[model samples]
Target: MSMREINFDGIVGPSHNYAGLSPGNLAATRNAGHVSHPRAAALQGLEKMRANLRLGLAQGVFLPQPRPDHAWLDRLHQRYDTASPHLKAQALSASPMWAANAATVSPAADTADGKCHLTVANLMTMPHRSHEWPDTLRQLRLAFASGAFAVHGPVPAPFGDEGAANHMRFAAEHGRAGVEVFVYGERGGPFPARQHREASEAVARAHRLDPARTLFVQQAEVAIAAGAFHNDVVAVANERVLFAHELAFEHRDAFYADLRRLMPEVEIVEVPDARVSLADAVSSYLFNAQLATLPDGGMALILPGEARANERVWTWLQELVAGNGPIRRLEVVDVRESMANGGGPACLRLRVVADPATVDPRFLVDEAKLDRIAEIVTAHWPEAIEPGAIGDPALIAQVEQARAELLRALDLVELLDS
Candidate 1:
């Protein structure tokens, strides 16, 4: 019925520590552009996301302040700057840029939201196991202790582990429910690093997260650059179960089968695919996710007449509402820019806190356009109309639908699941 807030997601680390020399990575660079500068590539990802999220607030995460404990990224960047053709080719062949860039995209919120929430990448800078996490965690914790949500990747490794778990536990203790841990991807970040995988699994176990939370997404394995994924996820600031499309396709049957087997009372919808590249997917997610809220009734509807790639976010939203899910208020808004990076209504958002129950809807309406919109839409398209005709339905619907579709085309879902 109404639209509000747009975010400019910032990017961080393309550090060598996360993604070092790998093979097959060269091709990804070529596919995106002709630059060896990983940071530039990361920027491309950020720009794409900015373009996709049309309706939410635009803000970005500042890069980690360079520090000794986090110096591995610096080393990697140094190497990338001076990488030998042989090494570069080898690294490129293996995968795209470094894995830590997965953490680059920073989450943002509206100025009025009252709290700062940050999304962090879960991958390690170096593959080596550690008794202690880098000091970056402590610094970040101290910096934004009062944040609304600190969304990050799984705490424990996929199968299970201790070191990262300790880091995650520390984060949890400091963060409380403000922390929402999500899984990266299925194949799991460049190269076949068994130790990293083991560590990730261990962290997951230590956190007592559902395996479904341990996403084996597609983008995490390839195109994602360190923090590129975070930008899109951080844009949204509402509470709802994030339904990842990549998860649905790669593991939907099992996820659903398991859900039915364990929590049958839960209703699920298989998110439809938007056939876009991974970078695009993250953008789409960030742009459209801001307006999402819990629905009011068992069958509240949130349908976008058109969105690219058949990304059925509106459909999923409808299903969630129909199931009487915890998400109670749903507001579908316009997102044209983020779709370029493969985002939709849900991809770009990062939920910081549930909205205050008594918040007024008048805040969302554009006072300047309300009367004019109502007059025009009511005069023309009635099928796509919202109650009371506060705004131009045809114009709003057309704009919103275009934004949603663009996100589906960009592969924001792939990035989200990853």
Candidate 2:
């Protein structure tokens, strides 16, 4: 079987927020609502993505755990041999740190298959928001150019000025073939007065790539201006693009109606208004389900939003389950940290190539039988161990001990095939 590139938005550790409290002026004030503002949302987002990836694992629709976004790969991709002594030393230190401290690597448990795949992205980090690309891109390209991963250029539009323009130019100049550039309408502020055509033409000139083929959208706008563009998918262009909030009932209907009018023949999916928490959205969309392949055998629902928030994804899955068409299962990986910092699962994981080798044969679940499976998985949690309460050395030892214990518990889980 050929190794297929899996597109899963990897789960991010609460690094910016969950890593540890910051000491700078940006740190949260005393008695603040959260330990950190952006960090809090990022942690919540990470939790949701974890839930999604976990669900994918449980349902057998996903490969084993995803690759981390840290160090091992950085060493492989960096050219320390060509660097000056200072740069070489930096690479040397950085390489090991990436391996030790960074969390990116292929899954130990993932067996090769025609469909086995995985992907992960940095939590709460957008180039547009930080206006730190080129530099960020250099680091990312060094860290993640290996593993045949499809990389999405850093989204740096949330920052004011022509960040998006700069990002597009950068991608056009140096981006690999699969780089996707998704634009938002107005989160940091209102959309620039310049029209999409003007922006597209400018980016094309800067990057040297065809502007016609670049993926563009009106993200985060109050009123959807994209109804006119007969482009790809049109989702709920709201602030938080997840199930916790849905499109207004009237707006939702209108959005769909407009979509049909503009592109009657185009495949469309509408996001639903399910009030699932951010955590639940991440878990269900990323972890618990397999990516569903379209009948044409070309992947279509490859989006950068919540599974529940993209009506197209939900509809595609429903159609398959409803016997409406021919379908192949693809894994769905969520990578967003939360609505606060930016990004959804798609924003995180970039697909390198569609690997048929990464698909799990055991992917299946009866919603009716889900509760029973959860009960069995839950029973493995013993009340006897508390690593947080132990000494550092003892805690490390306990973790090793508990890992063995958990493996033993898996012996009782029928859902997990041996």
Candidate 1 lDDT, 232-265, residue by residue in tens: 2322212223334442223446644543444334
Best by lDDT: 1
TM-scores for the candidates? 0.38, 0.35
Model 2: residue 160 alpha-carbon error in angstroms: 5.6
RMSD of 2: 14.3
> In candidate 2, what are the lDDT values of residues 250-279, reduced to their tens digit?
234454444344334333333333433323
What Cα-based lDDT does every candidate model obtain?
0.30, 0.28
* Model 1, position 360: C-alpha lDDT score: 21
Ten consecutive residues with minimal summed lDDT in candidate 2?
94-103
CA RMSD, predictions in order: 16.1, 14.3
